[model samples]
Target: MSTTFWIIIAGAIATYLTRIGGHLVISRFDNIHPRVEAGLNAVPAAVLTTLVAPELLNAGPAEWAALVVTAVVSLRGGLMAMFLAGAAVLILARQFVG
Candidate 1:
């Protein structure tokens, strides 16, 4: 109906095509190369770094406390535990720090 709507539709179609194309290509291969598999495994860490690095530049006490707790939890717990601990610390710290 509008330019923005058309742009959103185009983007959705593009995203779907890329996802399907990747799946099709991967399915055709009998086995993946170890290097490629390692690269794929590293994607999550790279993406997380990209997301968190910028936030650290503008973080406050609450954010720092959450990050510290998250790091500590990550060293000895599962992902869910780390996330929950970080979120709880952030919320509780904000209540007092703000």
Candidate 2:
């Protein structure tokens, strides 16, 4: 909409180009450093731990209730039921609190 918007668009383009260029440059390798490979291998577990660790560490009573509902819904009917159960919890909480 303005000069700053254009600059942001250019920045995004530059960032995308750098990402593609980096992958093209690095993926050409026949062999890579073992440490680099090991770091890459740990990335998935690291991301999952970071995402779940906060919830696990700081969960309160309400969170425990939600977690129990989510687990049961997920086990019985997968993600859809879990989402519905979460919405139900929020609505029920609002009914009592508000």
Candidate 3:
């Protein structure tokens, strides 16, 4: 009921409408060009690598050590290994730090 609430509601509505509008417009284009499709496919991977690279490389000693353990487990055990290793690291970190 306040001005801030109305502003937030308006912003949410605008965001939703913009996304829906993009989908509608792009849907009318019969087929994506091959280059554009390839770019789209690579976008998420590029973004994720950019996001994860710093965390994986630039952390403190324990964090780096955890990542090493994670990498070993991840390589040997697949996705499950990654999750278990991450959980172990998180628990250990909490115990030591917080």
Number of clashes in every candidate structure? 0, 0, 0
lDDT per residue for candidate 3 within 1-98, as digits (tens), equals 99999999999999899789868877899998999999978987899788878886557756766767787787779878787887788678857765
Predicted structure 3, TM vs. truth: 0.55
Ranking of all candidate structures by their lDDT, best first: 1, 3, 2
Q: lDDT tens string, model 2, 1-98?
A: 99999999999999898779858877799888999989978988899778866886776555656667777788778778897896687567656654
Candidate 1 deviant stretches above 4 angstroms: 1-22
User: Which model is ahead, 1 or 3, in terms of lDDT?
Assistant: 1
Give residue 50's error in model 3 in angstroms: 1.7
What lDDT does each candidate get?
Answer: 0.95, 0.78, 0.80
Error of 3 at 63 (Å): 1.4
RMSD of 1: 2.9
lDDT of 1 by residue, 1-98 (tens): 99999999999999899789878888899999999999988988999899999999999999999999999999999999999999999999999987
**Colliding residue pairs in candidate 2:** none
TM-score of model number 1: 0.70
Instruction: For model 3, name the residue pairs that clash.
Output: none
Stretch of 10 with least lDDT, candidate 3: 56-65
Cα lDDT for residue 98, candidate 3: 50
TM-score of every candidate relative to the true structure: 0.70, 0.45, 0.55
- Ranking, TM-score, top scorer first: 1, 3, 2
TM-score of candidate 2 to 2 decimals: 0.45
